[model samples]
Target: MADDKYYTLAEGCPFANNASAVLMRGKQGSGLGLLQDTQLIETLAHFSRERIPERVVHAKAVGSYGEFEATRDCSDFTSASFLNKVGKKTPVLQRVSTVGPESGSADTSRDVHGWAMKFYTDEGNQDFVFNNTPVFFIRDPLKFPSLNRSHKRHPQTHLPDANMFWDFHVGNPEGIHQLLILFSDRGTPKSVRYMHSYSGHTYKFTKPDGSFKYAKIHVKTQQGVENLSSQEATRIAGEDPDFMIRDMFEAIERGEYPTWNIYVQLMSPEEAENYKWNIFDMTKVWSHTEFPLQQIGRLTMNRNPQNYFADIEQAAFSPSTMVPGIAASADPVLQARLFAYPDAARYRLGVNYQQLPTNAAKAQVYCPFQRDGAMRFDDNYGGDPNYVGSWIKPTKFYQDAKGIRASALALHTDHEKWVGEVSAYTSEITDDDFVQPAALWEVLGRVSGQQDRVIENLVGSLTGVKYPELRRAVYSLFGRVNNNLGFMLQERTEAVIKTVQN
Candidate 1:
């Protein structure tokens, strides 16, 4: 009798009862394998094609399996089954990443961290493709490509160019708030476990009665917020590029799982109508004082992936993956991402990427219309009717919490009642754009040396810009936020440039 646990070939055949490679050996042990050795040929072939296309953005990341337990009944706010009752638990997958770095880049890089979570609910998968910050660089969907490209390597030099980075921001100064946050200590989070994640785009928390309220989701770390100083982050990047990833893994291994408290800031439709700032603006944050966070649930990461490639690397998440109770708002950036994220996944993974175990919905999925593509290993609906409205085997559609068929739900909302003629539109920077950043600078003053540290961080990157005029434009942009902030940045940056030139 053979041990069932013994190592075997991929097809479950014993490898001649030996673990050694089947190689043709000479007298002196010089060996060359023949192509007839199926094991050797198969191993080499698989090794050659092991890698898949890395994500264009957020290439470097760490992921873990988790569970979200609803602590408060949120049925009034949303009909999402996962949050319908207290103590309801849903399996979740979370991936935290640095947006601007390559897959091989240091984990401590000073960049916005992408915080994406997928909830495998009883209804379907609901994904929150969020960020560590509550705001983004650009609100206009048209500028999305330019914003990402500018932060990425220069096409001509194939290097990170500060000129390109500053030129884009200076031209589109609406990102000033996010820039201030990025330059602050918050940019260099101590680890994924210590940072809070926010849904920068407003989402709709809908009920079964055709009513909904605008919401911004927040996940606050239970371990408490911690940050690395600019100097410390740079040092860690040099000494241990995988610092954050290792910290998270070792902590979980020790049974000390990381946890986060989920909260949502809700606003009524009437309130959003007269809001001071555009609720749809990704660049703006809802005032916490007015729309206080309501406790929703808690998330705990208690399991680590057995295989990183199979679990984390292949997992695909998108804002479009919503269930019956939740839906997307008319925020232009959010609208664009609903299409871009899934499309990117299809290109990176295969068209049948959703069938991958990591991305597959835990609930029963029966969309025969979405049937075929390459790498589809499922039954592909078998003998069932692929087309809808068939009397032989009609497909069943999900219903809302109120027993209303989802298909019968209204397609339009009060927010979509714009009567203006269709025309091209671009967001322009205004005094309102700088108001929040100025307030943030003042907030930084509350903490000792925080404002100075931010200026130092700014100077560190801004000094790399070879063009003087571009640097000045950045200074002017910050100046609009705060006169003193602009002055310190200009003075310190110029001093650094002058010293280097001398």
Candidate 2:
């Protein structure tokens, strides 16, 4: 017996299997299409509206379904159920993408990669919107748009402008560390499976008692770190624009699952007060020697999405999608992202985007207050009061394992007492900012030919800057990182510029 179902219209009205168009035929075998063909009209209309808005950044990505297994209990640090017991597992969706590139852009482009993961836990959904690098371009929230714009196309030229890129970095010198790393081999990972990821912003892992410790999450690739050189990446981009995406998909298809060890560098509030660098600074990394990496879990991607557009493309993640016991810190850039990410999702997908299958929480949710938006499919909390504090239908609330209502928890120990005073504030450049980049430079030098590769990559891009002043400013910016780096960039960049001019 045939098991196949007959193909039909979207509304389930089955039509005869025949030529789609209804045409008025003449004796000469010529025909004019009739306007009454519902099938043809519907197909065209749906095709026109097929695509949703692509992400402004990290537009191109490879996603996978995975499991995060708790390797070590973290009950002392966080009461998050997913990490509270050994051998416990949580379902996860992972997406790794190149920043500043469109959906059709080359996967091997020299750029930062975004590593976003969503954990479907018992409490709710938790998202780790991370980066391959441990630090970011800027720490200040206000510079976010400017930083992205500088990396994107020039308004008038509609092309990537090296002058704009260099000028922004030179002006905002705190990004030197990230720039140096970006120009290095690490910027071009061989595949998404081979690169490590980090939570660039410090987060808080709170216990049930309202006590929390600052944390920077790190996920080291079990497949090991593998990167492509500038020449190799360029060749791959020309040869196979979707190289990384294909690599991941084929690997999973062959049962070669990619895995990562999750760890966190944790610091107490008391320790953060005396730390050398500000814990909230997104541009700086917490030293492993100082805080130390504590193992939490292991993540393994074992499944591929059956449909990319529905399962991966529509999936939304935000830093604000925190479960109980895991929360955001006071990092300015992180604070901005918490708002920006959800807002962008609402605009790109819809206000009801969370109702989509991929983005919905596995745990039960009861937010009647968030009802009645575009594409709202569920019952709008039938007969239940939308507003809070209704005596007629009092809503049930959750309590922790200790039987204490989460809402009644004491104020956080790190909460600041305010005096109703406000002042204008902006992060200023200081010698401290360059300290990490200089150290990273020295570390790069320790690897054979790594420093030269960095210099070559810098010169390759820096040579595109038509303005001599901008080139000089970039050299000065590097000089702050290391005198040798500054000299090499200046000499190599100018030599290339002159050769190109001649």
Candidate 3:
């Protein structure tokens, strides 16, 4: 019977033994082995290649399968077929991960979480690669790699250096708003299931008639936001490194799946033309009061992976995997990601990474030219013409789209050409950047002990800084946000540092 089966080789051939391999050796195993066994060689070779390259940032993650159901018609906003009709369901694969850790790092580490969703829609795969925080540390695309590297370990020490982290932030105080939020409770989410995700960069919702609007996506957790304190997170990180992943799996096994309500804040071209802040800035968030959230769909994660390595590990999500009617805004960071992410995946996986079952789109793709790469999957379009405009056996083309540019796919900027003097787009901190952060501080003050909690949390982490100058600069940066909060943070942090030093 199939149930009463014994183990065999990968090719289904019966093996000599399952536990051990036969090896010819000299007497008393003191001399070199003269003969080599095929099974032993194959087993050792396969074992050496068992691991794949891990993700650079979000190396530790948990994946789940789900379905997204459109709850409201968004036809007026965009022509994307996935959101045009209510109750339409699309299969989704999602992975939530800790951003700044290795493959074996703890899930409860105090870091931002990467929230990625891949929608296998009829039009193709659309990937929404988001983060738990709405804002980021930098607005300039060039500084992205530097900001991430600063958060990582040092080259000389080979360990995470707090002085390096604070040095970067001190030099670029424009990240003060994101820094404040990161040191708060929100940064240490208790579970991925209980946290919301936001598209940090502005995107586009395009219409068929070449009209488009700037939009930002937000997905609020239906389970509501929950967080672990820094101390608690540290304890769990040491006690059970896989606590969050285990909890999510156990919750799903008990039929309590996690869900999030998807919404988008849209800005008309006219409104964007007159907006106070740059609409394309990734470090800023549009006020919800001005642009209310328009609910579109719901995402529910119901199934865990059958095979972690195949279904979860090999899954790839990139900003370039966009479908029709949904385009990217001219946000510099976003434009950089559109080029960077897919390239990184090609390096990690093979060039034909998209052909993997977990990454392939459910929609029909007929690109014959993108072929003959490493790990080539599929039939290579199966005897179809690889080149275009073949006279002997010409490939049929869509007459409407052939040589005709899709006008709606173009980015919708206010002016068609350059109207202002060309200058470098650099990030500089001013009193204006502090306004939002000050408002956030006041809002936190309203809640009993929330301000204290944030201050305490900041003080605790600030103790990691060994350099007094860097610590002092950190205080000054927060001082720009608020006079009292910064002074208090300095006082408390210095006191703690002194105590530990003594």
Q: Model-by-model lDDT, in order?
A: 0.90, 0.89, 0.86
Q: How many residue pairs collide in each prediction?
A: 0, 0, 0
Candidate 2 residue 477 Cα shift, in angstroms, is 0.5
lDDT tens readout by residue for model 1, 1-502: 4666776789988776455576789998979978878887788899999989999999999999999999999888787889989999999999999998899899999999999999999888999999999999999999988998999999999999999999999999899999999999999999998999999999999876778989999999999999999999999999999998899999999999999999999999899999999999999998999999998999999899998998999999999999877999989999999999899999999899999999999997767678878988988977654666445434443222224243433243443466677888779988999888889999999989999999999999999999998999998898888898899999999999999999
- Over the stretch 1-502, how does candidate 3's per-residue lDDT look in tens digits? 3566777778776765877656555688655433455566778889999999999889999889999999988888787889989999999999999987898999998888999999999888999999999988888888877788888889999898888888989988878888878888887899989999999888988776777778999999999999998889999999999988898888888999999999999999889889887878777889999999989999999999999889989998999888777888888889989999899989998899999999999987767768888889678877655766566435555324354233443345342234578789878877788888898889778867878889998887789998888898899889888999989999999999889879
Best by TM-score: 2
| Alpha-carbon TM-score of each model against the true structure | 0.94, 0.95, 0.93
- Would you list the rank order by TM-score, best first? 2, 1, 3
What lDDT tens digits, residue by residue, belong to model 2 across residues 128-183? 99999999989888988899899999999999999999888888888988998999
Q: Give me candidate 3's TM-score against the actual structure.
A: 0.93
Inter-residue clash pairs, candidate 2: none
Clashing pairs in 3: none
Better of 1 and 3 by lDDT: 1
Cα RMSD (Å) per model?
3.2, 3.0, 3.3
Ranking by lDDT: 1, 2, 3
> Model 1, stretches more than 4 Å misplaced?
1-3, 17-32, 390-418
Model 2 residue 214 distance off true place after TM-score fit, in angstroms: 0.7
